[model samples]
Target: MSGTPDGQGLAPRTTPPSITQRHTALGIEGPGAPLADYRAAFQAARLAMAVVNRDGLVLDANPALGALLGTDPARLADRSAADLAGLREDPAQWAAYLAVLRGERPRMRCTRPLPPVAGAPRWAEISVERTADGRGVLLCLTDVTERADLQARLRHLEMHDPVTRLPNRSLFFERLAGALEQAGRARGGARIGLCYLDLDGFKAVNDTLGHRVGDRLLGAVAGRLTECAAPGGHLVARLGGDEFALLVEDSRGTDQLCELAERVLAALQRPFDLGGQRMSLSASIGLVERPAAETHATWLMQAADTTLYWAKADGRARWTLFDPERNAHRMTRQALSSTLRPALERGEFVLDYQPLVGLVDGVVHGVEALVRWQHPQFGRLSPNRFISLAEENGAIVPLGRWVLEAACRQGRRWQLAHPANPLVVSVNVAVRQVWDSDLVADVAAILARTGLPPRLLQLELTESAVMGSAGRPLEALQQLSDMGVAIAIDDFGTGYSNLAYLSRLPVSTLKLDGSFVRGFRAGEQPNPADQTIVEALVELAHRLGLTVTAECVESAEQADRLARIGCDTGQGWFYSRPVSADRVSALVGGYAPAPAVGSG
Candidate 1:
């Protein structure tokens, strides 16, 4: 009485009267006692209702029931309910109807296509209830076609990325898991592949161009990726941001994945016209393939991400295959990066000094401070292994500050120990240390704390870093230089040179890149080109009033040539390799004449 009979698969609503209830409510316990009132009430009902005998034949019908079935009320009479509902053809469906007809099941409910009558084939939930008298069953039909359509529409929206209309990360993983399960149950092992791609320099697009343009670019990229994927029947999805993924089921092997990745890259190479502005972009892809049984969706994605990283790191716009060995190395590198801050706090980092020798006299004039990690497990580790990592994560600021303080402390100690001849300590400063941090403040604080004159501290930055600097970064450098902290462009001539701009900066020294110094061979005639370039560079520096320091002077001949070329100083293995503070004292000891190094 509370809900429509047999409402199991249908929404609940007030029940239509049972045949016996109809008779009783109409006050007609006997045949022919009938009722205009009973007919009117039944006809006015909103739900489609009917009465069916135990033989599954319709005994009576309301106007709503007649209209729903697309039959006249007279035509509905004595018609088999199973036939009218389109269930007579299927034995299983008919049997379900028979249960309620025989009073075995109090109610029966099902959603199915009714016999074609009018417009489209209408789908409905058919509910049947056995009468208390066990003579017939009452039926109510509810149309659910529109509801089903609404649900389908909602499901489509939920599983797709709004921007690109591609399967979102959620649906991608779901399909991947399902594919893996299918592959696991197959006789011949099926392989699956995932190609993870990220747009290179996407952030720059967002920063320089508006996000509206960035979004348009992403849409364009997604379209290209979709075209590449369509040929191979691969599924492409946007995994958020500028990252997208391709899922290839039953993949042949790495060759197929490689081809797909190459196609994707090629597709992206074409310039995009975003609102009439032409832009060229490239993507870095990570290709990973394996037996489906051997990997899950999560790990597959992880491996793909790792491979993609190497592709970007190896210089972007290319695809990199997943290599376990490379992954192991990355894991180690990640572990090291994680421990760097803690290592600094634990005093696990120490400075080693390599003398910046006077090339002409071979005298140890100054020491370039090299920071080394006295890693607990790995022993002494060189800066090459972790310096770039530090720069990437902005850890270089603190790490460089610590190195500056330590080097200055040593420089002060050297000045004290040998008042007649003091040593200058050149500490390498990362670009991030200059741009992202307060270098002037840090240097001033450390210089004052260590009692080391600012002139004794030479801050070395890469040629690229100095050349790229502008605005606040250049202003910060000027401030430090004004404070008497000497600024040297290390590895000069390695980057795009801007001598005109370089002359305007407060740069005090030019350290020739190791490549140029290595070009000067020992025990052989110096290459004329190398000599010309070095001489030219040295002359240019001298004209700018900047001292020239040649790096990587590995042989006496190389050193002699540099000094002869009027290079003011040199630092390399030809000098002492980076040594401890104790060794620094030993190297600088007993140098005659002026031992005192002055502030800038």
Candidate 2:
């Protein structure tokens, strides 16, 4: 299908055998065959053929050949094709024709003109072969004009996308590789610039405009992108989906990269005209400019990728370049988050419990479950170090489940060991885990699997995690609460909350924001205002019939103030640090009521 011999064209076309005899003037040898058989076969075969004398005189022609010449075979015979072919440029067909006749050279193909019947003179591939018996020559011709056109189309499809007609990933990588290779060979080895672009809200376009319009917008975008390239040294490629990559070669300076980037940003700032609708969007660009020396494609691409994420994080329509110091910190966080799940299976992650003690009774109440990762590379990482990343990357689904099961198992063990205290365990829930996963089912499964009583497990959710989760999430929360598992609002007051939402939301406990408690001792004097604020929060919570737990009670003075304010429970370093289960047991049994506590 691909490797075709010279003078053979696969595109469907017609050529006059008389036109072929014109090229026989170029010293090409033809096959020996009777004029009748050759004539019949030439007309029947796709290839055009004509019989000619050594002098390039047309002796006989087929009907098919006449059609290609825009004339009849009877009219073409007895005519000198060489003199007629000379009317076209490069008219040396006869010189080569004489060489074959003199046995000075082998048969060959030559380009000759066949004056058009309609538009213009057409180009034909002509082959003249020597007869085995050494009589007159047989000339074969194929119209290669159409073939050349088709080859152009095939190359376009291979390098460019059919839909947007933009350079696809393949072509982009090809150009990128070439740029890097060239950069490496240079004196200073200039840097290659990468612009990783992603549409900010293209999904909204598909949803609103329909895919047809979305496709048109992409095509128009492709056109605009092509206009952003530096004169002759840049390539833009669509890396599939809504992502695009730009490779700027000879980008000796960052100034060129910045200029092109700004141009792209300005172009996208204008609204696109799609049919009657005017639409607009922005792109987040990640940039990494690396020298060609000893650099691999993977590192360049990854640097660009990291920078692009910064763009998304800092809000779109902006570009961020890779920084070694910043990327190293990010890499460390990524390494730890990646190891989170596998760490669970390997027993490298464990839970530490901080007791939520009862103020009135001055006894151990429940324990807040805190997770820790003893990473081999990172040593030990607190939840704050890697939690947000886990939630963003969907690692929380696995992490939350691990915490739930582990706490449930430990809670069940402690309840049996210390039946009177019967400490409850609370596990924090991430928004992603709450929205995308069946938290109730997971909780039920963990409880059933761990054989922990429903009353001894508590689920803690942030206010924002519950704000938008109305229908099914509310239903799930109610179902779990009804099963006697307690639900608490963690980090209260850090997020927006309404009294109505507080009453409507299915919850049993409100953990006071640590900020307020931490703010206590920093006051100029004994701030009655602080006392009044804590009392008001407790009164409001008590009105909703929700138990209030004051967090960060670091001193006996703060504990006394919180307790006097009717704060039902408290947990902080004032009692004991989050510690091992054995340590928790010893401390809880030996816990003596502290006079008061304060932390700011």
Candidate 2 segments exceeding 4 Å error: 1-157, 161-168, 198-227, 230-233, 237-245, 271-282, 323-341, 358-362, 385-402, 412-422, 429-457, 465-484, 501-506, 522-531, 543-545, 597-600
The CA lDDT at 76 in model 1 is 72
Instruction: For each candidate in turn, give its C-alpha RMSD to the true structure in angstroms.
Output: 9.4, 10.4
For candidate 1, write residues 1-600 as lDDT tens digits. 221222223333355445666455424456775566667777899888987656565657888887887768756755567767776666777777777766677887888776555555567888888766676678888888787667767988998988889999999989999999998788468899999999999999999998989988898999999999998899999999999999999999999999999999899999999878999999999999999998888899889989998999999999999999989888878988999998999999998888887765656778899999999887889999899889887788889999999889989999999887788889999888877788888999998899999888899988888886889889998998989989999889889787886788899999998988887786677678878988998999999899999888777667767777889888877666778999779867553121123221
Over 4 Å off, model 1: 1-157, 160-169, 185-188, 196-233, 236-245, 261-286, 303-339, 376-379, 436-438, 464-485, 496-508, 539-546, 590-600
Candidate 2, RMSD to the unseen true structure: 10.4
**What's model 1's lDDT at 66?**
79
Output the lDDT of residue 564, model 1: 71
Best by TM-score: 2
lDDT of 1: 0.83
TM-score of candidate 2 to 2 decimals: 0.64
For model 1, where is the 10-residue window of minimal lDDT? 591-600
